[model samples]
Target chain A: MSVTGAGRPRLATKKRPGDTAREEILDASAELFTTRGYTNTSTRMIADAVGLRQASLYHHFSNKDDILDSLLSGTVDEPLAVGQGIQGVEESAVVKMYAMAWFDADQLSRSRWNLGALYLLPELRTDRFGSFRESRFTLMNLYATIAGGVVQELESDVSAGTEELPFRLVETIVNGRADTENGRGSAGLHHASLIATAAVRVLGFPGDIDGIHDRAVRVVADVTASSIFEKKAGHGQ
Target chain B: MSVTGAGRPRLATKKRPGDTAREEILDASAELFTTRGYTNTSTRMIADAVGLRQASLYHHFSNKDDILDSLLSGTVDEPLAVGQGIQGVEESAVVKMYAMAWFDADQLSRSRWNLGALYLLPELRTDRFGSFRESRFTLMNLYATIAGGVVQELESDVSAGTEELPFRLVETIVNGRADTENGRGSAGLHHASLIATAAVRVLGFPGDIDGIHDRAVRVVADVTASSIFEKKAGHGQ
Candidate 1:
């Protein structure tokens, strides 16, 4: 307990409404859960970090598992939504793949890659996360569609091999970089271009590489600008 | 405890020499450490898995940290040696990269991938693993050298970008596949070919992709055949 000058426990500000309370709890838990394993963190620690009385914390979340569910759900839904949006946009198949890769890497960077990395733990592998796994499978299939389309259009001899391999390659690049201590810091605007470029090359896209890089950068910039504007307008908030 | 027909604790065979005992302990610990995590697993559990009494286990190693050091050291040394051998081999830069990637993916697959995944755990990120980390760094630098040579010889406008990215990409594919329930069973000769193909492309190698893929397969097959012959001759055992 933090004590004020008079040695009394400092009062927390008046509690927020349930939605705000839930958001704050999730924001705090995501960081804690990423740095410390979910099992190692406790509800009490989360409550303390968020300045909520222990009993009050339950108003927003019933338990740690509930918070994890929310966190994992939020992390996947945005990129997958963005990916689905890209498919609706009229663009070349290669451009769409670059746009999705760029968007996904940007989203992962914003989430502090560690949050996405939580799935890697064996403890989190259970039937309860089956929905989460399904959502991810859907997202990868979306990527594979864009990649396979390009391969079919470009070369008849090559099959683009397997959908799973390309998807896994893109994932490997993202998560592998995330494992580095400085990975987050290094994932700036240009890094998204690097990721997109690498993604296409791994898919065996036989296109103009330089042109793809330029278009990917523009797509990422436009999306980021729009999202920033939305946040500023209090829509995302 | 495993129950026997007579319902008494089964008598373990008399203790082997220290070398054999250490190897058994490491073998048991690798599986337990990978599945249960190093921190969650106890020395007692490891000893039990290896058919050693808890006290007798201590005679071979001081504690869990020592056991972990041995396990990590063994895992890194084989691949590092193989990587170094590739560096010394007189081959084209692309061939060397493919050989290194093929050897690494094969070695990691043989070790069940969990052995490499242990480095991702926060608890293992300590000074004790400095030598292990250095050996890995050396191996990556060797890869970067080959990659740089390929990029320079092929494209004047292209930069090698970051050496770390390609290395991490390879690791991500290996570990990501490893996370699947039946990942080990899925890793066969064709998968190694797929990994090598993706690896060189990600490095921006402007060679004939088919030619590189064919050479990579031959290199991997030759190596695998030689290793099996050695094992049959009781050299590797």
Candidate 2:
């Protein structure tokens, strides 16, 4: 929320400056890209918004695509870094999961509207912006790794050989494509967090392994199964 | 997927020979609005796309906003109509839930890209468009009503009076949001469907209700409890 001098309105880089100009450019680009969209936004418009000449803007970025690539890459990398930092903390899996969710929620919510806008834009999916694919994979991997660690730490008897418990657990929480546009709300996030937390807890963490696995299994089964049953009843009647 | 008029370009309107030209203008406008965005898409560009004079186009729509308003209202209304059709059907709560989910999902996926685009546009959100607020409210109410009915049909002991159950269940399945750009995927959808089904089943249906309820409750308890335990264990470590 803090705007530094680096982000202040200055003349365009007809005369080359340092990384400060680059930072300012990106800051402005993220805002515009989120609100106006990439295809609709022009380099000149970006320069005008930042008090720079169109020609000068090119000195910093070869084209508008460069700015977009930079913006998406930078934004996605931050969360991954945060995840990595927490991994080194040596905290218990449950605490780690909470920490990760808290971090993701905090960061995502700050610019949730814009981030949502960016994702919805079809242009990002095209090959022109390959960052989309890479960033997505990176995020999935991060979640799986963290969730897997928690699973291993909690479940002593359950061998990790049969299934990728952490990946599924994280996927369960994070996946939201179902239920249409309504699916993307605060409620979904809460459900995912609850499910992930429960999964980790049931796998038997720092507590007594006895009964924990059964408890966790029963919880998942009941929640999933009951939902299915309810839907069938609605249909039958 | 079927185009009504394949090779032959249908007349934009049959109201007036002159109005046909206007219809073509609007048709072109809708396509651009979905792809290029509202603000970025100019009246001149729209007219050009339709092979018409800009002045002639204005004869139909007062301005670009008029074109956008028409497109958005139509999109919103179509879904509302589909949702309304469900109320007339007399079925069990479980069946209704599934049908509603299916309907919602189908509509969303069909207009997935456009909905995101239109929703993100700032001008569209402003008060220039009449009754958008009412439309949105109506949609939310429709979802709540459908979800509530499903929950009621599933629960046998209405004597207990669990009012919040409907809201919680509906919100969990319908309004759950994701951090990713696409906002959930196939896996998320499956999970939500499963959860909804399980919830209804546990509440119990008519035949062999007691047996089903007993089994459901045990399963839910075990799953919920186990996940919680896993979370605690991870934290402790």
Candidate 3:
């Protein structure tokens, strides 16, 4: 009765960061899953981390797979919706490309845990994670779509299918953060705009993208302040 | 004694590719670790896949960690040596960048299994894989050095740390292959030169890369034929 949920009383007081019990579980799971290997971390361990009994943990997540699925989906769903929402925005492809890169890379970098690191978990290769993979692929396609426009606008000779490079360039921040966190490389290798610039540059953006940069920054600020997530906040995830 | 190594009899006939038992073990481990999940795979599973007794597997590798380490190191060691050897090659940074990207990405694509998938293993973040992480960092720095040369040659205004993007762009092929194999994307998304072009282009190569592409192809052909591995062969692995 002390806690917000219908679950039994917590064995310990609130300690994790999130506002709700499910979010608390996710926050704890994210830390444990990324630090301890996914296969190494168990459902019981996750429950214990969040100060909840095993039964209460199941009330939120059916199993470890569900917890991981929710964690992975959290990283992508916003970007996927945001990327899709902006498809019809009246900005040029260059600005759109910059906006998406800035937003997505920033999300990957700013997340409390580097859940992006889990994108390659071998467990994800299974059918259980197929939806996550598809959402990711859809995000890549959105990047490619915007990047294809940049390719056309620039008239660059970049090979076909190279459009995916922009998205891939953005995703490199995942590794950049991982390596830097491990103390293996220089710091700030994954700065948001730096990666955004490089993501656009990968399309042969040529020298002096200052104009595109300013416009895209404005676009990012404008669209994100009023993105679809806000428009449909209470419609249900 | 029918087999080459000093171990017990085999459990199955030769089925894996490799010139030696060590190579065969690596091949088997690469496939299993990338698919079955690294933490889930036991030494016995690898031995069974390779048709060796668990004792024979131990004779070649101290444990599962050692096998995983050897598999990962195999993917990076050749690139590091060749990349370092060519640091002084009489070629433009553009050509060197092209050659390195082409060679490294091709190695990733051409590998029988997507061992590059293991590069992000959380277990690799541990001290046990410190040497492998260091070698990979060395390789990235080599790419950055060559990429830095390209930036200077072009007088690019890229951010100070952006030299790393060229290397990271080449690595996208790892994800590209994993995605394609999962039937999530097109087949040739990981093609070597397509990605190499995108990698070099990230350095602001601009249009008309045909000349640089041709020269780099020649560099790749020349250097790989007489590289250090051949010169140091039989000097002891």
Please give the RMSD to the true structure for each candidate, in Å.
6.5, 15.2, 2.4
Per-residue lDDT tens digits for candidate 3, residues A1-237, read 234376777789887877678888898999999888899999899989989999998888889999899888888788876776566679877788888988888888888898888887778878899898888888888888899998898886777777877788778888888888777647555678888887777776765667877887777666666746557322112
The better candidate by DockQ, 1 or 3, is: 3
Error of model 1, residue B196, in angstroms: 1.0
Count of backbone collisions within predicted model 3: 0
The per-model DockQ list reads 0.29, 0.06, 0.69
* Candidate 1: regions farther than 4 A off: A1-19, A156-162, A173-179, A182-190, A214-237, B1-19, B159-162, B182-190, B213-237
lDDT of each: 0.62, 0.48, 0.79
Clashing pairs in 3: none
Interface RMSD of 1: 4.2
Q: Chain A TM-scores, one per candidate?
A: 0.76, 0.58, 0.92
lDDT for each residue of candidate 3 in B72-108, tens digit (9 for 90 to 100): 7777778776676566689888888888988888888
Interface RMSD of each: 4.2, 9.9, 1.6
Q: Assess the local accuracy of residue B104 in candidate 3 as a C-alpha lDDT between 0 and 100.
A: 85
lDDT of 1 by residue, A170-204 (tens): 45443544445523333322356567767776666
Arranged by TM-score with the best first, the candidates are: 3, 1, 2
lDDT-wise, the better of 2 and 3 is: 3
Which 10 consecutive residues of model 3 chain B have the lowest summed lDDT? B228-237
Highest DockQ against the true fold, candidate = 3
